[model samples]
Target: MTQKISPNNYLITVANDRYANSTQLFRAAAMIHEVIHAYYHSVVDDNNSPTTNLSLNNFPALYQAYAQKTYPYGVTVAQHDQMATDYVVSMAMALQEYYYNNNPTPYPFLSYEVFTDLA
Candidate 1:
């Protein structure tokens, strides 16, 4: 969940129970994913206008650029946001997998393949 705690700050929360038994990499990835959401909310959405109407053409240039970058096929603004969020989350998960596999720490209990499959 994402919450606007102040005019200039936002907070993202994940259920504690969800990560209680997860690996450090998994937890970090989850947090990073939420942070990406928060960043999109605060910077892209401007902490307001949760839903955007691209047809109105009132969004920032960055948002329009992103829409063009990912949804050149004429998707709605909401669809663009969803795609961006999925992309960010997937990238975070991939980074987590990379760290889990490359780091010297003995995280034998952590299974990157299982985590990716589950995700």
Candidate 2:
């Protein structure tokens, strides 16, 4: 979940259940995805009026990589958010693979179902 707390600040929450019972790779990827979302939203204000400011157009590569090819110019606010989510998840997965090869100790672990349920 994403929420704008202030003018340029956002809060992104990732529930423990999201990665519960998943693989280490999946957990690491999800962590990266959420972190990226936090970073992206920090720079690009999603709550701003897209029609007036065209904030969505600022992320062209995100649009090209995740959105439909027909929308070459830009994407709607909803499309932009979805594209950001997809792009970050893909990037996170790739990063997780790289970390696995280089340094695997700090990778995210799968949440324990019992603990997650309690939380």
Candidate 3:
């Protein structure tokens, strides 16, 4: 379910599992995304009207710009989505890497292509 975090200023919605278990990178990106959203709503939509609100029409354009800004090295909408996905996977990988690094136990893994597609 979704909830309003603030009066038309912010709304909270349930995201996919990726976001829920993301590492610091995803966390950071999520925060940035929200801020950019708010910025667009408050500034672009309001026409600098001084009322704090987001404009639905401006969000997609703002999101595109945000994605480009976040991944300037390889910028694209798909790339941005992949990066966001990677940020989540990195969390799981980091934990597993740490465990395997310390333990002598062998590991079993999945097909792994699922992870590599994040390009």
Candidate with maximal TM-score: 1
Looking at model 3, the pairs that clash are 41-54
Q: For each candidate, how many residue pairs have backbone atoms clashing (under 3 Å)? A: 0, 0, 1
- lDDT (tens digit, per residue) of candidate 3 on 23-95: 5434544554454445434443444334536455455466557767886653344444554664546534544
* Candidate order (lDDT): 1, 2, 3
Q: Worst ten-residue run, lDDT, model 1? A: 47-56
Which residue pairs in candidate 2 have backbone atoms (N, alpha carbon, C) closer than 3 angstroms, thus clashing? none
Q: All predictions: root-mean-square deviation over Cα?
A: 7.7, 10.1, 10.2
- Candidate 2 residue-wise lDDT, 1-119, digit = tens: 66668756777776778667885555655555556556655555443436445545555355445545655554344444564556644564465455557555785553444222221
- 65: Cα error in model 3, Å: 17
Candidate 1 wrong stretches, greater than 4 Å: 44-102, 105-119
- Error (Å) of candidate 2 at residue 23 is 2.1
- The true-structure Cα RMSD of candidate 2 reads 10.1
* Ordered list by TM-score, greatest first: 1, 2, 3
